[model samples]
Target: MAPFEPAALPELLPLFYRRLFPHGPYGRWLGYGGVVKNYFQLREFSFTLRDDIYVRFQSFSSPQELERELQKLNPYKIDIGAVYSHRPQEKELVFDIDMTDYDDVRMCCSSADICSKCWTLMTIAVRIIDRALVEDLGVRHRLWVYSGRRGVHCWVCDDVVRKWSPALRAAAVEYLTLVKGGAETVKKVNLSEPIHPFIRRSVGVVEKYFEAYALVGQDILGSPESWEKVLALVPEEHREVLQDEFPKKRDSMQRWELLKGRMERTRRQGTAGKSAPCYADWEIMLQFCFPRLDINVSKGLGHLLKSPFSVHPKTGRISVPLDLQRLEQFDPFAVPTISSLCEELDAAGDDAEQEEGGELEPKRRARGRRAWRPTCGSLSSLWRRWNVHGEESCGGGVTCKETSEASLPPTALFLLRGHCWPQASWCLGTRRLQPNPSAPLNPFPPFGPFLHKKH
Candidate 1:
């Protein structure tokens, strides 16, 4: 494959939308099984064209029409907006985490640039936030997507989540956020007595990566300059002691031990200031490595977010859904670019023509034949899951249709009772509904209008 050139995006985008774009799945995801009258049509799409031209409030009558418009416009970047009439009722609960937020603590990269070492911060963010969403908030459906550049976007699509008010959304974000304040604040994280379980769990997630990420890869205490920043987070009483002790240590790990010892000894002796002494270490860990969120993105009802599968204008990388099952091994650099995918299709077409003993056809015609087809392995996997929503028969004259969160892994996407029913169908838009015998009983016991049971 030839090198990805941002300059050649105009030529490459047409071919990408023609051959590699997964229109069927993209349509199904946004359509939401026609949950409301004109739901898909009410939602807006914004397109950024060549020369920085941006078109907004573009809605479609159907997914088919949307695909045609995409092929025609060949947008440089696609941004999805909220449904016009739905207000806070229809939009997904979204969260944005950019690497730029970590500039203060990030040692390897800053701004738009990111490296594997710094990428660990993203992995940690996903793990910590995902756990809270699932275990704490009772969210069963969430889609995690790479931003195609330096961050990740999470869309929580559970029925309850979509109806969350702006205040509720803000509360959820507040629960997840720990590192606070701006560049001027010397101490970003402050803790009170008896830390919450959610925070304790977040600290546990950070602990696994803190040593490798902060102490070693970042070398947060390797030099006096960096160590001073670390000292600022601790109690004032212990700062001078650690300031002298850090230089004598050999590495970050040793320097970290010196700081920890000072704090622990101070807490035991009750010599610390009015601040909570016992929580100092946890505060420092969180202030350095916790997920830094753009709170407005999560709380606002009409915020425009870059659409998944949209080609980033600068990087040419597809904003693909992430498979969290293999999150640790995910490499941002390995993501396929539009230029690479187009070249791949060209190579595959040549091989096919050679095998058949026929002359190669024009690139447009060759690729056009594969339009709406999955071209690469990751994309193919995404397509298969998305295609599941089109209606797959579950035998016994019942067809299973995934209406929402179709991009989630099988275990998350399909779980009934305690077992993994691969062909499980959602309650929405199903013609035949046979109640699973082993399904857990509803705890509400069929009560009032607010807590009535499903018939």
Candidate 2:
């Protein structure tokens, strides 16, 4: 991947919004069947301009209208908000995970920086959280997206999830949250015997990567300074012994084994006090590896989240959706930047070997749409999962009983409202739309609790 140049955004964004934005399925995904009257029209969109000029409560009559305004404004960032009447009517239950929250445990990089070694934390997070959402909570459709910078976001789009109350959202977050307290707290995770099945499964996910991620990649016990933090999480009597034994061990793996031995010995002897946790090893693993969430982002219905496919202004990277099937292989650094994509499209169009009306001519015209084919494919796949009723494709208006949405072609199902569309094309042709910007309104009202920070 090429290094993202922030200075080129002004030149790159117009081309991006024009050719690369996945507008068709994006509209379908947000429309949600128009189950409620004027659902799409009532939803809010907020845009941030070049000079930090913020515009909110921007509503559109249709997806075409939204597309037109997007080209007109060329927003530096786009945030999706919930539909509203007097208050927030409905919104997808969302979750935000920032890598910075794990600064205390991660050793490879600090603050907003990330590398392949530390990126495993994100992989672990997606696996654990996604499993719980599907198996435990019974949610069928979940859309995961890279934050374009240092984190990941999940939008739970089950029809029932949209109407979840704040208290219910809090409960779900609480269920997923294991590592607690702030930086000052010495031991963030405290575990006891007979651990819940959820915690056990979560630990199973963490254990797969713990040996390589923590012991070798992070080297949590390699130095006295770092081992001191690990020792603090262990029992009081064992810390002094581990402190003496750590330097004697050959490597971090050996030191970790020694620590594990002490814990196992204590468990087998039954000599530990009631105050001491027998499952401290698991707790330590959870503390260092479990997903840390922004509870405020998940709990508030009115809170706005960065829209999927929104470009990170600073990095010039698009927030593309994640394929759970390829979760382990996902690489944040490999995601395409606006500059690289534009160059790819330009290069494809300028191919000298191609004849004017040959087979390559159609491909040249489709280049703009295919530039974002991976992203559009993700959105299409998400729609397949979302539209479980097996409704016919936009071209075919007939609904077939007992037919799975997956059985139909993805492009046909892309438009959920049965709008007439070409069966062979994934391209939703460009239209220049000019929308009047709504007057800016305060996103956070005095009465309700809303997430203040831009997620």
Candidate 3:
């Protein structure tokens, strides 16, 4: 009888009902997981209002019984439905709508209280949709009231555009989806100065909305101009209400300014000249620079290197710098190599047995202990040996040193025992000196058909 006051309706209730029956009464209902329904005879459509002002229908005669019944229903668990159109004698047609599109439409107010966060989100949605319809799609769209007892709905029926392809629909959905998580994408687009004209226009609209909302003390929306107009229509006394309804304008501006400053700093530090690095880039860089090291980059370093340092501007070769500072954090030379250590040991001393016992023993033994030895010829084996298992010993208490010494090929042993340089000419079996002056010592011994003496 009070003209069905819109302001009195619970904000979440309309969204709940819409989710339950999106396609109308004819839609197929998907039952809630644990909800139970009971049939009751009702003489009138009774509205049972809770303390939060959320209304529900009940056949119970007393308030105590209604309250008791309400306690059983779980508000978080809700029923969902799909709308299907039935044509007599024709195949049933279903509207395949993406439910994610509704995520942008948030509850602005709960019961009678104003939700600043939700209101801010709703304002952004309104502006985003408005910009998409007017600029991108070039279609006329209008905001409609769902009798205020329900949530507001936007009707996008412009006679010029009837049906859209799936791709086009997906794009529309993506555009709407951006409004939900605030202006993150918008900020990216703005910073990069996107080449797409439509996107640029949308970005401008979003910026304007943010500015206008701040000016009027309202929750920042996606379109500044539209909100200014909305502000003009609101009564003066209600203007003060915005102070409590939205984030402080100075605080919001400070955040935006801080972000912009960081971007500028990135550009100045030559990071923007290379590839646009995200927070993940720094994370990966930190991991690579210090493999086993765990240390937070100083705020000064973070500020200086907001983006990953790149080698080329166009190609953008990204890698952590292997300087002294970074190397100090983690031992870069800790990556062991058997061949290099063997070469070093040979250069330092002539006899392996002598090297193992003398002053050089400690160094050679340490090298032998850390050196990686390959067991299999496969690349997978190499990766497993090098990365998965570090310096895995083949024999008990002997380490890879003993295993490598034992497995040395005959030719390699000849080269080692003869005191012949790895590149010098030498024969394996007789320990005979070869006459050929040009032949280099091959690490593999000649077998059968391959046994040709170098002339």
lDDT of 3: 0.28
Residue-wise lDDT of candidate 3 within 253-349, one digit each (tens)? 4433433444444446655454342222122111111111011111011111111111111111111111211112222122112232233334323
Better of 1 and 2 by TM-score: 1
> What range of 10 consecutive residues in model 1 has the weakest lDDT sum?
443-452
What's the TM-score of every candidate structure? 0.79, 0.79, 0.27
Candidate 3 collision pairs: 208-224, 209-223, 209-224
Q: Please list the C-alpha lDDT of all candidates, in the order they appear.
A: 0.70, 0.72, 0.28
In candidate 2, which residue pairs get closer than 3 Å at backbone N, Cα or C atoms, i.e. clash? none
Model 1: residues >4 Å from true position, as ranges? 86-89, 265-276, 358-455
Q: Which rank order by lDDT, best down to worst? A: 2, 1, 3
Residue lDDT tens for model 2, 1-455: 45779888888888877766767656766777565678788899999998889999999999889989998999999999887876897888999999999999988899999999999999999889988998899876677778999999998877788899989999999999999999789899988776799999999999999999999999998999998988899877777888898999998899999888777766776645433446777889999999999899999988999998889998888786665655677778766788876775565344422323345555553443332233233333333333333223221334433323332222223222222111111121222111112412211111001111121
Evaluated with TM-score, which candidate comes out highest? 1
**What's the C-alpha lDDT at position 13 in model 2?**
86
What TM-score would you give candidate 3 relative to the actual structure? 0.27
Question: lDDT value for candidate 1?
Answer: 0.70
Which candidate gets the maximum lDDT versus the true structure?
Answer: 2
Q: Please provide, for model 1 over 1-455, each residue's C-alpha lDDT reduced to its tens digit, 9 standing for 90 to 100.
A: 35789999989998887766767656756776665678789888999998999998899999889989998999999998777774534678899999999998898888999999999999999999999998898886667778999999988866677778889999999989888889898788888756699998999999999999999999998998888778878777667777777778899999888777756665676645543456677888898889999999988888889987789888888786665655787778877788777776676555444534535455543443333222323333434443442222322323333322322222222211011121233222223323344444321111111111132
What is the alpha-carbon RMSD of candidate 2 to the true structure? Answer: 10.7
